[model samples]
Target: MWKITYSIVGYDPVEKEWGVATQSKFLAVGAVVPFAVAGVGAVATQSYANTSYGPEGMEHMSSGKSAQETIDLLTSIDEDRALRQVGMIDGQGNAATYTGEKCYDWAGGITGKHYAVQGNILIAGTVEAMAKTFEETEGTLADRLLASLAAGQQAGGDSRGQQSAALLVVKKAGGYGGFSDRFIDLRVDDHKTPVDELIRIHRIHQLYFSKSKKDRIVPIEEQIAETLDHQLTRLGYKKEDQPLLHTFKDYLHTENFEMRAQEDGFIDLDVLEHMTRS
Candidate 1:
């Protein structure tokens, strides 16, 4: 009935990003389960699901409220507070989680330094698995958040099974064209294995949108140059007339790897791998 869900809200201090990853036994759970604002916070609202808590919690945190305070304020005025479950992580990485007293059996939550994991109508170890994974997994905020969902599923997730999953992460100037904060917002609205689907799409999303990190950029020479020339010729580019970098740029633009392409005589490692693989 759209009431069974588990989620983790996390903040990555290293990247200054906030994220929410969730899975549920309901259709299109992504639309209602996750929310975040760059330099503000992230929230996951579920259970009987008071949708307003997502925005209201973020709004309160934006005004200098701690994650716990924001949760307190949101649950305070709601007449049906006892039916709601929510987790939040503020910009400073302070986290909090709440499970309403009247929520379904097996509902509860756990919070730590930079993450809050909670669930309703879930198996006993769901939140525990999520918490351990989020703390131990190392990567971008999106990576850790998504791993947490996978771990939760492995530990016996929502009793009724999976239908939808979502992953959302936000950082200042991290979106497409660097004009928005929606760095990664991918969803599996209805799927037999929603978390797996979400992970697959997220890999593609990173390939197409994320910029290359400095450490991963390598000079365009040797085997990389040879490979690029071979791949470009297959695409009908004349490398003799144009420099390898220029020809690679054309290929990057054509393949929608424009965001990860660089002009400093170097190519991102992942982009190079994609070029060779494709």
Candidate 2:
């Protein structure tokens, strides 16, 4: 008597790959429903949260199992015998998913290059619609995942209604300090419109936290100088000081310029230059 829907989008820059997978249950399901390794693979385990399927599925893929073979092996070994669902995508972008013989009313999945989207106990048409929407949407992997979730909702998602949603994406050197990077990892553990809320947070991440494509960064130039001057004036800095503003190198050489800027709540020239140009 439970219904769940989930989706995941993952990318590995080192391998130049992208993928998606999903499954669900009524509990905080996506936590177990989706698993991903930055440069290895992604998996989704559901239909009563067969959590082992996630890691084990990835293991099979890592060992050179084709996506279909991995799913077949996992299904063959499941103890429940007739209540499980799962999906996977490997570094090569091969994809596969499964729904057991005795799952609830409406449950199944579809796989594709770079992605898979699925749901269980959903309305008759939602799962495939989600997969189709994901396939058709444009933009980053994150955008396509969100679109798929939205489409599922539009087509009557989770027969029981919404509670939680999550997203995870990873790439090599994608984390902070390049020590650990998750391109996108956000969740709404419980919410009325979890998918929409997740989308809002994703937009915020793209605007501020996400690293821009290398081509998107505009070099600091004279146009930015004027913009910085205007911004400083609006923030109550003396307009006269605009011209006297030194380059970042000059500020670094000054004894307390950095501290002064911090105290005044003004961005350093280097940051201002980047922001204004961007």
Q: Which stretches of candidate 1 lie over 4 Å from their true place?
A: 213-226, 229-247, 264-269, 276-278
Across 1-278, the per-residue lDDT of candidate 2 in tens digits comes to 33366554444334454544332435455565667776677787766667787678778888888777888888887787477777777777777777777877677777665666666778887867877887778777778777888888888888878787777776677655567746567777767877787787777566545443444434445765567656555544534543435433344233233322422223444345433443
Q: What's model 2's lDDT at 124?
A: 80
lDDT of 1 by residue, 1-278 (tens): 33799999998888899999999999898899899999999999998888888888878999999999999998999999899999999989999999889999899999998999999989888999999998899888888888999999999999999999999998899887789999888989999999999999999898887667889998888988888788788768656779878887887887888788776688888987776676
The TM-score obtained by model 1 is 0.87
Backbone clash count, each prediction separately: 0, 3
Cα deviation of 71 in candidate 1 (Å)? Answer: 1.9
Off by over 4 Å in 2: 1-3, 8-27, 212-278
**Per the 3 Å backbone cut-off, how many clashing residue pairs does candidate 2 have?**
3
| All candidates: TM-score | 0.87, 0.74
Worst 10 residues of 1 by lDDT: 231-240
